[model samples]
Structure formats: C-alpha cells, structure tokens
Target chain A: MATDDAGESLAEVGEFAVIERLVAGRRQPDAVAVGPGDDAAVLRAADGRTVVSTDMLVQDRHFRLDWSTPHQVGRKSIAQNAADVEAMGARATAFVVAFGAPADTSADLALELADGMWHEAGLLGAGIIGGDLVSAPQWVISVTVLGDLDGREPVRRTGARPGDTVAVCGELGRSAAGYALWHNGIERFDGLLGRHLVPEPPYGQGRVAADAGATAMTDVSDGLLADLGHIADGSGVGIGLRTDALSADRDALAEAAAALDVDPMAWVLGGGEDHALVATFPQAPPNGWTPIGRVLDGPPRVLVDDAAWQGNPGWQSFD
Target chain B: MATDDAGESLAEVGEFAVIERLVAGRRQPDAVAVGPGDDAAVLRAADGRTVVSTDMLVQDRHFRLDWSTPHQVGRKSIAQNAADVEAMGARATAFVVAFGAPADTSADLALELADGMWHEAGLLGAGIIGGDLVSAPQWVISVTVLGDLDGREPVRRTGARPGDTVAVCGELGRSAAGYALWHNGIERFDGLLGRHLVPEPPYGQGRVAADAGATAMTDVSDGLLADLGHIADGSGVGIGLRTDALSADRDALAEAAAALDVDPMAWVLGGGEDHALVATFPQAPPNGWTPIGRVLDGPPRVLVDDAAWQGNPGWQSFD
Candidate 1:
C-alpha cells in the first residue's frame, strides 16, 4: 500500500480506478468460483443450503467517523453481519459490501476501509468477494454475508423450551461500557474504549453450541435482556436471569462504571454490540459456555432475579 | 393493503412492529427454508452454487423523493441488484434489504416500499426473505440478491471472441430519455417519465442468452457504450455497433429527444439504467433479440459505425 498522494479524493481518482486499487492483490477464498470484476460473484455452497443476512451502518447513527477510524468502521460492519449468520449455526464464507461516501473523501480512506474489512474477514477464513462504491452525503456501509450450514439444522430463537439451561459464550457489556467511556471523553480504560469501536465475537462457538444440542440461540446485538426477550417471546417461555451468574461481566466494567457514577450491572444487562452467542440447552452446557439463566414455563417475558428490569431495556433503532 | 394510520411515523410504531407489518402475510418462495423473524435466512441452492450481487441507492443521489414515490424507489433498488444477478446467467431466488431512513418517516411509506419490493420479486417468483430497518438522516436502501445458477455455467464478460454477433434483448435509452423529459419538467411523455423512476430490466433473458450459446454478457447499467466497452475490454476484442440496426430504439425516443432538442441516438448510446441484456453470440441470436453490432479482432474498444461518437460517453458515479 502506497500513500504517495494522500490528498487525492475518490472523485479525482475516479470510481473504476479506486475500485481497482481496493481489489488489487487480494486473494479470494477457494469457495469463490468467480470473484471481483464480474457482474456477480459465484460462491460454492457444498451443503446445498446458504445462510444469508444483511446489516447497514450509517455515519452518525451507527458510528461517528471521529470516534472510529475507517478501518474500525469496516471491521465493525463485517463483524456485526457475520454474527447474525453465526447465530444461525452457520459458517460465514463470503461477503458483498455496498459503500456510500462523500465524493471529496480521500480514496486512501476507502482503501483503508477495505483493508480493515479484509482483516476481519480473514479471521474467519472468509473472503470479501464483491462490493459497490458510490457517492453520498455521508459515509454508509452495508454488508451482506453468505454462510454455509454444513448439513446442520439452523438454530432458531423459537426452539427454546421450559427446563432448558440458558448459557452464553463470549464477552458481555464490553461494547456498552466502551461506548459510555468514549461518550464521557474519558481517556482511561483503553480496552473498553477500543471494544466500543470494534467488537470481538466468539466466532466458532456458534457451531459448538449447535452441535451440543442447544435448543435455541441468538446473538446479542440489541442488549442482553432485549435479545433474550425475543427468544423468550418466540418460544412462549419465560426467562429468569441470575445476577450472581453474571457477576464476572459486571466486575470487569466496575472501574469504568465507578468513574462515570453509573451502575455496572446496567451495562451487563442492557448494553449491546458485544455479539456474544446466547443459547438454551436441554442439559448441562458444553465447554466454553457459562450457564447464566433458566427457561421456565410461564408467559413470555424476561425477569432479572424473578422481577422486571427497572433500567433502560435496550437499544432502540428510532429512540 | 390498508393505510389506516397515515399519520404515524416509524418512531411511533417502533422498529420491531414496523418490521412485522412489512413481513406479515408475505409468501416466501419454496426455496427459502427459513425467512424473516429469524436471525438470518436460509435459502436452498439446488445447484450447489449461489450467485450474489449488491447495490446501494442514496437519497438525493441515486433518486429524489419529490420526483419518485417510496414504492418506485423500492422497485428501482431491487431491479438494479436483480439485474446484476441476471447478467451472470442465474435465476434470482431471494433478496435481503437493509434500509435507513429518518425516524419521523411514515411507517405506512415503509410498508409501501416493501410492497413495491414484493411486487418486483413476485415477477420472478422470488421472495424478500429478510431486512434491517434503522434511522438515518435521509433514505438509504441497500439490496443484496441471491441467485441459483441451476447447473449452468455463468456467462462472463471475458468470453466473447472475434467475429461474434453482438445482440441485445430489452429496450435501450428509455430511462435516459425519460430522465431528460423529467429534468426539463416536460411531463407529456408519462411513460418515459415513469420509466426514469423505475426501470424494467429484461428478466429471465440472461438465462436465455446463456442457453443460446452467448459468449459474453452484461446488463446496461452504465449506458450502452460504457457497458459494451466492458465486454470489449474484458474479451480483448473490438465492438462496432451499427446505428442503422438500432433505428427502432432511436425512433421510439425521437419524440422525446426532439422535445428536449437533443439527439435520440445519444440517449440510446450513452444512457444507462435500462438494464437491457447485451451479449455476443457465435450465431444468430434467439427470438426476441436484435442484432446490433459485431465483434472484431483488434484492441479492445467500442465504435459506432466504424468511428467514435463525440457525445456524453455514459454516467459516472462520482460525476
């Protein structure tokens, strides 16, 4: 990667030339039959089933350019979409991105964004197969991921039943704690601040949970309680969360919470974007999973210690 | 489709309820094993291969709210992405859309947009499997289409050879001509104006061209000459289009061109978004295709009547 002309904008370099630069020297995965520079990319789905999902990140609504670098934005966009496919018990194999940005934005920034996307996709052994770039008032990135189910029945949120053990794999409340730290302009807690910019999802644990006979599962994108409520409602079962079981997550953010004069439990219970996988098992959970709750026979609702949560429920798109 | 509460906005309805309204009562294609309401969608790819493409439409960039309705915008977004899959000689099976709009936007309008997407998807017996809705400063819609190759090798732009006949299926320059008529506020040509808002891509014709032994193919998204230039460059051949052969398309737009005091041939040659399928065949094309050019042995370039045309070449994204 060269930066001889750092000030050159996308409009000055032209769309096709910028695209060529972004795509040059990138190696696609073996699953790609036809990669970039084609009308469409052809991907191999050996299991005869493809799992697909899409997510869009707006400039201010999703992430601010000042807070997250173009590379972090790219990684966050890819990670969130991949988490959706992972929740379905599938392996993400390919991605097609559509990016919109101001014409005066530097072509170098676009390359950085692509680099970040490739960096994250490489972690899963997947490829950034294709994408479209166009001008916009502000930066917008939309990613759609295609995954392989590998002959496994997809884990759905509606499959949970009474007596199932509620377990989770991956970090919780890190993103929320980071967001709060960043918003308050606090310079301390660098890890929490970094987590707010880019989340670390437990990649292979999804298939692990599915193989262990997990009855239901979903990724925590819209807060722990909020996402769990979806599974509870969909399965027509009540969920009871044990605060003692989640003490570790709260303790991890205790310092940040104390500095901001807020309750650490709020972040663990109501924050989102950690992309952790939560599932319900019929019996004791498998390795790398911690039991945090229990599925009970009752009306569809989520109760924290046998009572409703009094803090913010979760993130709302329009609120 | 009842618009009982036209005054309600997305913020009032909430994201989940608004999504429910859009997904309710929609019948998915049989190929979809799991549709909306799940974390992700699962589509059956019987050919063991999936063709994928994506496109993004921005407000006041790709479209205008005052000039086009929400339904028309929805149709245009889906049509453009579907055209990409069609160009690969595949049948589009499912679509996943991610939409961002203002919080104060009407939920009914969102429903109308979904209605328009379903309307277009139904034409191909496809389905709108899943989507994401979020708040933005302006409307932004990004659609990704998944297609099944059905055991057919995808037609690529690099497959053409010297001495092949260049043919086209579907209309040309209509969108560009309509754009001119609308730009000047001359609404007399209602059909042309409507076409400018929502294009009608020649669906299912990509497979026909593939079956007919077409060597190379592309959809006319960036004008006739610009798109043909892609095939020409990729195949390392010269493409000489015959103006006399395109008389029918020119004559059809002559009235609109005359009113705008511009040459109809310019629209036919440089206009884009018509999404007409153009391909090179070793023999005479199948029924419903018209011969328009010839592939010749030379450096890659596109010529009009053995010479270059001095006019607007085509639409450029940055410009």
Candidate 2:
C-alpha cells in the first residue's frame, strides 16, 4: 500500500491504491506486452523458450529486516532469482514477485521493496511485470523469474563429462564472510557486510560460458563444493578442486578470515549465497572465469585436492 | 527432503531429499523442454506469448492448518493463481512454486501438498515444473503460473461497453458461506466448509468466453461488486447488477445463511475467492454461463439495482 509523503501504513492505504502507486511511473521493457492492472500479464518470449525459476526469502530465515533495508531485501530477491536464470545460460526477461507482511507495515517500506526490485531488474534490462501483496505475521518475499534462452540449448546439470574443467565466474565466499561479520556484529568490512545483503552475481557469464562450450552450469547458491556435488551427482562423475586454483579467492578473503580468527579456505570453499556462476567447460573457459577444478570418471563425489575433507559441505535448511 | 515412506519429518529429510521426493515420478508435459533438477526449468511457449501471474498464501492469513489439510492448501494455491490466468483468456501451462515451512513439519505433509497441486494441474493439463524449499517460522507458499494464450488475444478488463451483458460462469458465495460456517463452528454442511477450503473455478471457461466474444473478463476474487468495480473503473463505465439475476446463487446459500442468521445476499454480492469468471459479453452468454448484470455508459462505479451497495464490498489483504 502507498500514499503521499504523509507516511501512511499499508492497512490505511488499502491494497488497490498501493498497487496503483507501485505500478505508476514504472517503465516496462518491450517483452512486457501487458503490464500490471490486468488479470495476468502477457510477456513476449521472443526465443519461444522460457526458463523459469522460483525462490523464497523469509524474514529472519533468509534475511533480517533489521540487517537490511526493504530495498536491499528486494534487490537480493531479484538478484538471486536472476542468478538462477543466468545459471541456465539464459537471460532474464521479467519477474513476478509475491510479498507478505503485517498490516501495520508502512506503505513506504512496501514501495521501497518494489524500488529495490526495479533497481535490480533494471540492471539486467528486465521488468517487474506483476506481483501479489498479502497480509502475514512476518515479512516474506518470493520471486519467480522468466528468462529467454535465445535459441541456445539450456546447459543442464547432467552434462558434465570426464575431463571437463570446472570454473567459476564470480566472487566466492564473500557473502558467507559478510554473514559471519554481521553475525559477530563486526563494524569493519563494510563491503563484505554489504555483499552479504546484496550479492553481485556474474549476470551474463552463463551465456558467455555456454557459447564457449560449457557443458554444465549452476549458480553457487549453496556452497561451491555442495553445488558442485549436485553437478557431480547429476552427471555421475567425480570432481576434484585444486586448492591452488582457489588461492586467489582465499587471499581475497584472508583479511576477513583473519579478523574473525577463522580459516579463509573454509569460507572460500564451503560458503554460499554469492550467486557465482559455476560451470564445466570441455576446453578453456571464457575470460573472467577461473578454472578451479576438473571432472573425474568415477562415482559422484567432490574432493579437495584429491581427498575428502572433514568439514560441512554446505548449508542444510533444517540443520 | 525425503526418504522411504517412513513418516520422516522435513528436518530429517533435508531440503534436497524432500525436493527429490516431490519431483520424482512426476511427468512433465511436452511443453516443458526441461524439468526439475536444474537451476531453472525451460518451458516451450509455442504461441510465443506467456501469461504470467503470481499469488501468495500464508499459513494463518490464507488458510489455517487446522482447518485445511496440506493437500487442500496446495490445491487452493494453484487454483487461485491459475484462476488469474484463466481470467486473461489463457490456459495455464506451467507453474513454479516456492514453499517455506517450519523445519519440523512432516515430509509427508509436503508430499501431500505436491499431490494436491498435481491433481489440480492434471485437471488443466498443466505441470508443476520447479520449486524451492526453505525453512520459515510458519508455512508460506508462493506460486507463479505461466500460461499460453494459444494465439488468442487476452480478454482484459478495460473493454466492456454499455450494451454488454455481465455474466458469471462459476459458483458464487459458496466460499464465503463455507467460511462463515467454519468460523461459527457449524459442523454440518461439509460441502460449504469444503468450498471454503478449496474453490473450483470453472476451468477452461475463460478461453471459451473469450472465443464467444467476451468484451471484458476478470475472476470474482474480491466479491462481485468489488471485482466488477475494477472492470467499471478500467473501462470508465458504470455497472448495474440485477438482484433477480443472481437469485440462483442466493438460493444455493439460503439454508446456510438461515442457519447462521445472516443475509444470503450479502455473501452472494460481497464474498470473494470463488474464482468465478465474471465477464461482459456482447450478447447472451454462451451455455453454462448465467447473466447477472449489465454494463452502463457513465461514471465508473458498480450499482446494485440501480443504487449503490451498502454492504461490505469484498476482501482486502490489508483490511
């Protein structure tokens, strides 16, 4: 719900009025044939193929309202969903969001969330075509992204083969590092703390990697090793990550790790939510991508320097 | 997450295992070029246009867990989103769901939710392609439906004219009556209580109405008066409803209304979430549709019996 600068609550502004305010003055791309205020929005999938993915963020569970502004939460929601599309070697075309909050939540906060979504979508030249608003006990944001593959075959998780080189094309462990910093209430490392709230995924690298003959792709939503384990399981191949290949990432995080009195390697290898594009290429990867591992012919498993490491593989929702 | 049919909880099953269990044994339609297990699911929109809409259901706000089984909740989520697509004169083809719930929730409850979704999708020949599972303080489900226009122009809400007849193609007031019954702890009338739990929109009627020269269309999501008000405002015209025309819906709920000591007409005219397709047609509505009102050529508003309605208009999220 929204109103003028008088600072009205969502409950006071009403649902329809808030929707009108959110949609007004917003520009939609050519792909959006029909925008908001309709029963459903029609989007032109020029490539005829639509890549769809969904993700949900709960207050305190995924993001804390106290740690992030509504705008950042909105941006993170869109960014993570966009990362999913990017992982499929597709370009995001549009997004539809569903947000829920208590009735007493401010209309300004609601609009701020939309502003954040538009900001993130604008980064990739996409649009927020439609959304739903509802009342709930706590804040919850769920985003669904639609993308166009533009005639390219989707790079799947099961396409990795023996001799494939595993590479990553975005920051590693930064979000986790930031998360740790935030958890410990550290005041230093503003950049790292910011990254934890809003990740910068390698937006177009999935298509670049695909064009370069990458066989398999996925975003590192979970830790790198854990996400690679999915690719390994999907492809029925073993993956070996060389520590030397990841030394740069470790060094990048060394300062943060030292400040926290933790091992940089743990964050570099086991941390997640960076939304980094990780793929397996049969040959050399495209520029800006770093080769960190290789596929091996064996049962599905991921290794660090040809050996299993006794550490947490990645995040487990329940655990 | 999931395991053998041993009645394991979601916490015990884990996110990945629960997803595997939910997606396993499910068949994806041909339009689904690529299904689950990827960062995103690829859907083939041969018509080149995708109709997208989203809706969110919170645990207590939308449906009480004690009042509804997980299966019913799943069906309601899909049904409501699909109804939006149907209102646009499109057939829902694919859906992506993002579900959040307490970690200790039973894995079987999660599967039951999926089963209910599949059952509803099967009715429309659609598929549930991809999803995300995360831990939340309470259950939250957000669904986005991708529909195909099949080359037909979408019937929007801004096209009704003075001479068009207003008609509806599904039950009305049943959900409201059911809700009231449930709220009053009236144990009798299982059908009314069930209607509150799950609405049965007249599926496939949207395209039928579009093909039969419907000038404007929308789902009765927020009561006949309120939803028609949307059309009136969008079309910049007035709408007048005939009480006699909606006598059938009133009659259907009369017994329940009498038992509950409330006016049946209030439920018929103001209740929402029935997902009934209400449209303005240039002529008598096609078979299976019942006329209820007429379009007026004047200031935008909805009037009952040539006068403004004094009862509650409809449901509002914040209100």
DockQ of 1: 0.89
> Per-residue lDDT tens digits of candidate 1, residues A108-133?
99999999999999999999999899
Q: Residues B29-93, candidate 2, lDDT per residue (tens digit)? A: 98999998899999999999999999999988999888998889999999999999999999999
TM-score of each: 0.98, 0.98
DockQ of candidate 2 relative to the true structure: 0.89
Each predicted model: what fraction of the native A–B Cα contacts (within 8 Å) does it retain?
A: 0.89, 0.93
Q: How displaced is residue B20 in candidate 1, in Å? A: 0.5
Candidate 2 has an fnat equal to 0.93
Error of 2 at B97 (Å): 0.9
**On residues A1-319, what C-alpha lDDT tens digit does candidate 2 reach at each position?**
2222357878999998889888989999998999999989999987887999999999888998779988999999999999999999999989999999888888888999999999999999999999999998888899999999999999999999999999999999999999999999997999999999999999999999989999999999999999999999999999999999999889989998999999989988889999999999999999999999999999999999999967878997888
DockQ of all models, two decimals each: 0.89, 0.89
How many clashes does each candidate structure show, in the order listed?
A: 0, 4
Please list all clashing residue pairs in model 1, or write none if there are none: none
Which window of ten consecutive residues has the lowest lDDT sum in model 1 chain A?
A1-10
* Candidate 1: tens digits of C-alpha lDDT, residues B267-313: 99999999999999999999989999999999999999999878887
